[model samples]
Target: MAKTGEADADAFVEWFRAAAPYIHAFRGKTFVLAFGGDSLLRPDFVDLVYDINLLNALGVRLVLVHGVRPQVEERISEEAQYVRGRRVTDAATLEHVKDAVGSVRVDLESLLSVGLPNTPMAGAEIRVASGNYVTAQPAGVVDGVDLLFTGEVRKVAVAAIRDRLAAGEIVLLSPIGYSPTGEVFNLTLEEVATHAAMALEADKLVFILDHGDTVDAQGRRVSRLTASQAQRLLKELPEGDMKLYLPFAAQACKKGVGKAHLVSADVDGALLMELFTHAGVGTMVTRMSVENIRPAGIDDVGGILSVIEPLETEGVLVRRSRERLEQEIDNFFVDELDGRIVGCVALYSFAEVRAGEMACLAVDPTFRRGGRGDGLLAAVEEAAREQGLKHIFVLTTRTAHWFIERGFVLGGPDDLPAPRKAMYNWQRRSKVLVKDLEAA
Candidate 1:
């Protein structure tokens, strides 16, 4: 029998191998990490700092932004004078904000400076840099309430930040900005992080919130969301950390930041898990549709075949030769996710009869339950309508009920256009289902 220590070592080796791909993917990429001030009070914050150091050691350029609301509240005697989410920073409040922000900055800097021997950060020569990297303008007044020193991010010193990142130093940003006239203004950490990401065109923007996973209406944790979907969900959610961070995540995506992530600060090693795993432990938001459906190109022939070959062997789909697929590639549509085609359908128009035949609808078994098959069918139908086809039909030995549930009706082979009927495989004994475009 294998010793327990040996077995544990084997597991560690396997897990490290699995994380290698992510480490390679993130190398040389820039990431902006923002956290609430309350996170620093947690015991696991030191572990988080270690994770950040690990990321830097792996060659990921880092920008850190932190909020100080909780810290400021602790320092101030009258918490009622300021709002929780949106603080109206008067002279007294601004002083507390400065003190809180400064103290947090120092604490974070000191944490990152640790290099004690035999510890996780041993020999980690991590250098952190901070400066007047954010320019600000007063928020002025809203709802007739003068938000004295409360300001919004007007600009980010992208060049200076880039220079520091290039020098292998972590850029730290406080929830504070400086005006042209040298006045210090209190800023929102979310705004600062978002603007900095957009200005630098960073690869990712990550928000470490005080909560765990974001749940849907059914209370199921949502793993991913497109910008539009996140916006809609935000409207329905009450005022909370998810609601606060989602808009910034969506804005980062819209402004061309490659990806935005929301992870729970309460979970130890959440950042590392989210960054280094294939399926992250938190919600990820992107600009548009996560899986894009578009016309197939010549290069996608292999992926298309891979998706359909299993179904063809199982007799769920008719087999097509590589040559045939290459020739008819222009008529194919594929649902591509992270460069892999997980779903595909082909549309053949019988223009003489103002009708079309939908064929070869197949989605990877792993993705079938995710509605990709429905999306491909819809795409094919839309293409048919665009070509002025009056109706569309499908021939299937199986999946008849699936199509029927999606608006297709039972139809005889005789209803098919003459050209399509002539090409139908009599030996296959497939059922003909049709749907009218106008009726749909």
Candidate 2:
């Protein structure tokens, strides 16, 4: 029992230490968490609240936008009519919508206010703020049906929300919007969250759904996608909550939001796991390709140094001075992620032999598992081919097998071109591997 307790304590400390970077990264940043009323009905709602309190404690500016669709359905006896996913809100249904929205708003506010001793909320002082932050215009006469009070988000009060956030208050928004003409409009949870994140340029726009992470056609959980890829996947996905919310996530990414996430309310601590960990428990959508390979410029010398310096110290990569790197920057291709260069490879062509030497291939240790090395290598190969080179080769002391696995063949120094062979480091005795570009 003592050993088990010690092991558990060590694990907890390690986990907390691992999350420190993310904590520092997210502090003072804004996140918009959106969910349906179905989330409040779940047994895990208390757990979600606890996590939200933790985020608040960590200094994350939060905007909580909730939908009352399920709550409104429970209040109305008649069947609901929908045209193109917007509820056909008549006079009677509009009243029910208002009641449900008000009830949900109060319930959320009360839950966020909890501070009982010995509980997760103990000593946690959370102030909840809610107001007319969303402006809406009614979706009038869609498909010949008067969608009376069903509305679309016209604008979000960015200044008002920022004021609350600056005051250290958690801003709450209901799916109920008020117009300038003194009329109320019912909005969708997706639209409100999307617009608010866009308007605030929030760091993350997260949707807590009833299901787990988004899956592919083979039922495999997908971890990351670009906006274009998500749009392509949307056509194949069946009609469900994931399908319904995916477009909103993609739209937010394309508009201006840093990243959009679709996480499961069913999974405990899904929000924390998704935001703090490298391998999140949800699917993330970005604006475009997350890993971009582009020709290296003079400005990329420092980033390239950051990636290759550790390997140079370890003797896996040859040492190059900053001046040398700057001069050869034009021959390098870098893999950039979120504006940071994570990987790089350089192609030096030998016109005498119509061949290129791929060198200085290194990826940041943190990003080594994402196939970025392969991407960087592909960029070099393509560049070599474009320059009319017939073959490409690499000299690696530690990563011979990695290159061999990627179609490179082991060779002796005699196989190298005259210029490269003369410059080969005999002291390192690195293994030379060559690949035929035409065959590839």
Candidate 3:
């Protein structure tokens, strides 16, 4: 038996190995982190700063955009005016905004400057940069009311920011901008972050929400959303900061920002878990469709073979000749990500008995924890249903538990359609599991 410390060491080794791919992929990539001022007031803020330091050390170019809503609210004496969530920013409130932004910016700089011995920041030399990088224009009047000093982002100094990032500095931006006439304007965090991401073509625009990730109608956290799906979700979300910020995130995706993530600052290490782990801890929004399932073509044969060859070699799946797979390629479906086939499954129809066979389910080992397998299964099931099949079954030698957990019931060769039953491998003695499509 292994000792507890040894077991822990093994687990740590496995986790680090799993994270290696992400570390390699994210090196030198730009990520924009946008957060409200309240995030700095949290008890776990030190941990967040440490994670930022780690990312900087790993060569991830960081642009931090901070909001001063709570800070400004604390400094103001009277109720703030707003129209559709945009602050009115009267002359008196403008003074408070300046003070609040200055104070919060100094505190954040102080936190990032920490290099205490025996701490995560020890030996980490993180340089901070800030300036009038965001150009602004007044939001003017909306709903027949003047928004005054509240402004919208007009331009971002992409070249200057790139230079700062190249110089090994984390660029920080307060929710404030300067107009061409040297007039100062109060801005929103979402707009500044989105504009910066779009201008710089950042790899990711991350929003550190006060709450957890986005959820569906049942309140279950959704792991991913396409830009269209996110736009639809915007309609269903209640009036809050998420609703206000989601549009900006979606807009950034449409404008060519790589991906947008909404994560919780309340959860310790949420940022790291979301970035390094396979199944991220937050909801990701992207411009591309998340469901890339499509009917396999002749060109997909190699990719399909790559996914199943190992399983076939291990005896978990039956071997298929290249010629045989080519002939039946039209009956297969593949899950593709970034032009790589990560998973594949096949469906064979027996129209005479209204039954179908689901077979050759496989996913790449590194991509298994995600729902690629489930997606491939769903694609096969949908194709079977389209062919008017009333039942689907699988013959498995090792994945019996997987099928059982997915609602398949124990069955025998006699339960199969006549044509399939005649071909059952009696010598192999594979377990036969069946599911009723109508009952599903």
The best candidate in terms of lDDT:
2
Candidate 3 residue spans exceeding 4 A from truth: 239-241, 290-440
**Model 3 lDDT tens row, 1-440:** 46988999999998998789899999999999999888888888889999999999999999999999889999988988889878899988988999998998899999899999978779898899999999999999999999999999999999999999999899999999999998889999888999999999999999988754456555667666767778888887865556667788889988999889888776789899889975577878877544588899999999999999999999999999999999999889988998999889999999999999999999999888555675677678778989999999999999997787566899999999998889889988999999897776
Q: Tens digits of per-residue lDDT for model 1 on 1-440?
A: 57998999998997798789778988989999999998899888888899999999999999999999889888778754444457888888889989998899999999999999966879989999998999999988777778889999999999999999999999999999999988889998999999999999999999998854566656666666777779888877765688889999999988999889999886778899888865577888877563488999999999999999999999999999999999999999999988889899999999999999999999998876655776688688779989999999999999997887567899988999997788878899999999997776
Ten contiguous residues with the weakest lDDT in model 3: 211-220
- Tell me the lDDT of candidate 2: 0.88
| Model 2 segments more than 4 A misplaced | 290-440
Kindly give the stretch of ten consecutive residues in candidate 1 with the minimal lDDT sum: 77-86
Q: What is the C-alpha lDDT of each candidate?
A: 0.88, 0.88, 0.88
**Candidate 1 colliding pairs:** none
Residue pairs in candidate 3 whose N, alpha carbon or C atoms collide under 3 angstroms: none
Return the TM-score for each candidate structure.
0.70, 0.73, 0.73
